[model samples]
Target: MCSLCGVLGCDDHWTSAIARPGIYTRNTDRLARRREAANRIRLANALLEPSRLKIAEWQGASYVLSSPTGRTQVFESLAHLWPEVEAMTARALDPLDPDFLERLKQRIEAAP
Candidate 1:
């Protein structure tokens, strides 16, 4: 069943198999990617030292974080980290079993 639709799993009565595919799959994929990217970016930002991150708070505005030199180096580092993040997201989106980043890291280490 589609959780959003409140349908039970593998129920043909609720799902229209012959008709055009539902938009859920594509939207779900997109949402998953967005979430994964956000998570990775957040983590990468967290890894920066205080001097590097330079996070600040504003009453109604978003905070900004950057290096002491005004260079946003965290985003540059993200490209190098994206492959691992992609694999982690893929594993997370898997229905059967979705291990968090810890297990994902072990899998990456074990991979050839």
Candidate 2:
């Protein structure tokens, strides 16, 4: 539920809910995509555990950067911030390269 709209899944339903009226905003969309990608990476890291990587409790929560590759990643600190950790991972990795960003920009620009 969104505090502003008092609607469930408002963020999903209204693409520009976080933006000012008639203004351009990519923060919400980018954050969402980053979150999705981060979760996938986190899951993959979990599967590779005991073989390719391992996770230890960091301050009471499971950290995902214990993986071999994760250690080398700039987003390694993401292991400490779960849930919202996706944004950290995305910024660190910059997974959305030029090509993907171009497509995303087009989509957002075309939106009504």
Candidate 3:
């Protein structure tokens, strides 16, 4: 149930809609989609951690981005993630910025 709407709802993002083997197909398995969502969250968190922020799956409908201080914003699309993150962290976050990419590369190299 959504904390705001108090109802179970799905706001499927387009990225998932275009996925191969189709989550919308009649025979699609729920577990596979769950795994994909979890994987996406894990990978994004790896990049987000340096900013002291995290994201959580919100009833499989929307994403809940949070700051270490507990501030949170719920968004239904990845398009909204950057602005919400920047608001929470008070820092501009550009995935394509060369300095940011260099930092990401260094983090990957340092990770186990």
Candidate 4:
């Protein structure tokens, strides 16, 4: 989907939150949820960095996945992220793959 449409959408993906974002009445809950969402993006980027793929929050409701080549896809849920990443980058993303894990570990250790 296009970025504009995704931004206009009111509901967040179920996988994007620990609790529903729209049902809360407190500011603290909103802040906590925002923090959780940012953390999710950070961790996902770690696994994606080797492939030169990255994802960012799209208006707090959806995610925008992009490739080093400039191709992009906007997806609303974590469920859709992997497939989009694979298709956009032309690389199979296996979070559990031994080599991928090793790369991630090395990247983490190498970070200064």
Candidate 5:
């Protein structure tokens, strides 16, 4: 008898199938990737103010960030957007800084 039979009420069921090594590994990997992507988006969004930066999809998979002044930066992937968003957030908070625009440009250009 399976160790979890008592808690699950039966030994042969969906849980048993999922317990198989191959299925468990595949499912866990897929779920982990999804969770990581969600967390990345959440962190990026939290760092950027909606009014200052606008993120949009381009060519289905790429992303673009547009500023209030009409400046735009393109990123190959959502993962590449986080650094730009972080720089924009810093600039937004310190707009009067002497080299803010230069640093922001460098940040966007350096993004992958």
Candidate 6:
């Protein structure tokens, strides 16, 4: 009676081919995790936008910062990427923080 049941239960070659054991579920889970990570990154970047900072993935395990000047700085650790970016944005929001860029560079360089 369900729409999915009707389509999946139908005698169709396409459905049969894709309905293999564990294939659909495994792929769905992987895609869902990827989507969730992407969404988190998007939300975090949105928060950073007002501070003139943006975080982007440089490679699978690296993150890059896009500054207002169009300069890019790549950090080689995923573990410290978000925290460092958040810290930078927090400091950047304050007009008194003239050392934010230096601090960001130090933090990224120190990240393992």
Specify the highest-lDDT model's number: 3
The TM-score that candidate 6 achieves is 0.45
TM-scores for every candidate against the unseen true structure: 0.30, 0.24, 0.75, 0.73, 0.37, 0.45
Count of residue pairs whose backbone atoms collide, per candidate: 2, 0, 0, 0, 0, 0
Q: Determine the C-alpha RMSD for candidate 5 after optimal superposition of all C-alphas.
A: 15.8
Clashing pairs in 1: 1-8, 1-9
Ranking by lDDT: 3, 4, 6, 5, 2, 1
Residue pairs clashing in model 4 are: none
For candidate 2, lDDT tens digit of each residue in 1-112?
A: 3455332222232433455432113344544544544464565454333234443323211234443456522222333333233343343323346754565566557758
Residue 79 in candidate 6, Cα distance off native in Å: 3.6
All models: lDDT? 0.35, 0.39, 0.73, 0.71, 0.49, 0.51
Root-mean-square deviation per candidate: 15.3, 13.3, 3.8, 4.7, 15.8, 15.6
Winner on lDDT between 1 and 4 is 4
Candidate 3 residue-wise lDDT, 33-112, digit = tens: 56766787898888897788999877677789988888889987666777888888888998888988898899889989
Error of 1 at 3 (Å): 31
Tens digits of per-residue lDDT for model 6, 36-101: 445645765765654678887543335677777776667654456556765655552542465655
Question: Residue-wise lDDT of candidate 4 within 7-83, one digit each (tens)?
Answer: 33223445543335533223235556556667878988987888888899978777888887888888877788888
State the displacement of the C-alpha of residue 83, model 2, in Å, after optimal TM-score superposition. Answer: 28
Model 2 TM? 0.24
Q: What would you estimate as the lDDT of candidate 5?
A: 0.49
Considering summed lDDT, which 10 consecutive residues are worst modelled in model 3? Answer: 19-28
lDDT by residue (1-112, candidate 1, tens digit) is 3445332221132221233223222333434433443554455544333123443322211233444556432222233333433342333223234343455556557758
Error of 4 at 13 (Å): 5.9
